[model samples]
Target: NECASPQKYHVDCDSNAVCVDTEEGYSCRCRPGFADISEAFNRLPGRKCVEAVNECLDTRLNQCSENAICEDAKEGYICTCRQGFVDASPNITHYPGRICNKPRKPDDDHQVSHQLDSCNPKDPRCGNNAICTDRKNKGQFICECAEKAFRFDDGSCRLSAACDVSNDCDKNAVCANVFDSYKCQCRPGYIDLSPDPETRPGRYCKELVNECATNAHDCSPFAECIDATDGYACVCTDGFSDTSSTAGLLPGRKCSNSSNECLDRSTHTCDDNADCIDTPDGYNCQCISGYVDVSSSANLPPGRVCTVQTTCPKQKTDLMFLIDGSGSIGSYVFKHEVLRFIKEFVELFDIGLDRTRVGLIQYSDQIRHEFDLNQYSDKSSLLHAIESTHYLTG
Candidate 1:
């Protein structure tokens, strides 16, 4: 009845799934997925299955953006919308799901920044009387003369000179033109200076009068000089040197001849043919090329010269003498002087007597003609007549 042992246990249960059991022995077993209910069996570890969800019906998914359907999937959900729908703040509003929207790319700096092509700092706004220059996209430059006006070569602006008005520079300064600017220099004759060229004008003419430093001869027996505001003036000295020579002289007042200096001191060339006798002030000569002295004596006294000397020498000696006989001489004294003058005059020209003749005239404030050479015989008779004349008293 109980025939099971390690050696012969199998003959008892081959059909019903029993086995012989020993240290090495399990005999018969059921196939996998088929359980042996009443028998003790070894079990394998199992996994918890991941069940599929329908996100469309699950409000917790919130998968759709706005105004769309949540398309459910086995794993998760997606948003689906018909065409032509938009939802603005679907995330905050939590309203209906959002529709399909275009994706956005990051913006470039050019799209966000503000720029000026010509006149930014490169082309900044200009000050008064200024001009703006542009180099490139962002390049801006300024050039001009300002209200006061100065100039620069490269980056700096410049001022120019017109000098129309004296105010272009200081009163004493001369405004000169430079490449891009104007510079100021002092007046030629004046010196001493101010700190600024613009503000301090004629104020810089601080040089004191160098009265004697130059040709400033301050005085003379003829005249004395005094300085005036702008320059100097002359005062007649008590002892007069008859500055009649300086009649209309200015600046260089001197005892020049009363006769016109222009008469002698002329640069005009003598184009006309003439013998020009040059004087200190000017010159006078006959136009010898065509003109001649025609005055000649028809009949003359014995020893008086009436020679015919021609071929005009450069100079024709003309003497004009002024004598003072204002009651200062005695009656006979006048006669003696006249006789002495005639004798001396004859002797002084003894060598040239043939070419020269002496004439006698008397003047005592009222010139009186005594005798002319056309009538007198010789210097002796001429002297006799001069001695007979009395001094006229005024």
Candidate 2:
């Protein structure tokens, strides 16, 4: 009857316990697994003790927060701080605990290299010839043309270069473009037979001289000949083959023909107002005022006269000479010399073919008028007529 009472706390000697209102007779004993129900919080119910409740089994009734530690108790478990940081929320006897700690450690976003600064999408740090790339974990800057490509003056990359005369090639060689470099190509009649990387890296490159090409034969007989682009030439072809065999062409050993070794102008000994007159093996190039023939040849460059602005001489000559013509000029040289003299005279006067009058008189014992004074306009006609003279007698 006492054990059957309601609303009043009581227990039996058999270790059975109950809370009831009224009891026939009251008794104290253990409840469930308790050895002593009177002080179940710290003791056993009679000869029995309360079974331990697994607080960690079901997190709902006695839930332990992520920030706390759980410990088993007779009827529940408790939570506490784990490590590194303290729990910001206090413990609650009948509720779950709250978690509070320092901010979580920041993650490494730059998988490439975190030491570098963050990349900018607008003005990237990559160089002019490089590419700016932003990757998922990090950013990178790479050269666009690879390491082999050389940088240009404009901060761009070029596979080849603009070739000029100053490159490390023979005088007969020209500059050509190659991958990331410039190549020295032998002119038409020249080639590089060597297998040197500086010259003959490919089948088409060789170091050899071409002497039999067009215009190369235009050089006088006995003159050394060589090849040139668009043409070939006769000169001191060999650097060491001057007439004197000097370092280059010089006095006593000049770049000359069979006619006059002195005409071979390889040296210098003349005034600025004079012309070089050939002697034997060397020449003296008279540097005439207002004239420059660094490479003095019999054929002077068309003098840069006062053409843009004319300066006619104060003195003028209208008289002309007519010679006797027996037949024709005897030899080729004589004829050429005569014609050359005529050309020189005309060039000296800077005469216009339409401005002046010329006359021709060819006499072979009996006088013959080839042309009248008023018939020819300029010195060219007179020169031509004089050059056409034929000698019949001495």
Model number with the top TM-score: 2
lDDT of 2 by residue, 1-394 (tens): 5455533533434335443324445434446554332232222224334554576777765555565566554445545434332334443212323452432322445233223334465775645334444544455533333233344444454432223212465565544333334445444333454357453432244433233322224444445544443335455543223364443533222454335433444444344345666644544444455543322213543221212222332234343546544445545544555444544444445344344444556566578775665665555565666556554443
lDDT, residue 170, model 1: 52
> Worst lDDT window (10 residues) for model 2?
301-310
Decoy 1 TM-score against native: 0.22
lDDT tens digits by residue: candidate 1, 181-260: 33344443445355663543433555444352233554443555554434456665543334444455553355434444
Error of 1 at 32 (Å): 99
lDDT of 2 at 200: 49
Residue 49 shift from truth in candidate 2, angstroms: 99
Cα TM-score per model = 0.22, 0.24
- State model 1's lDDT: 0.41
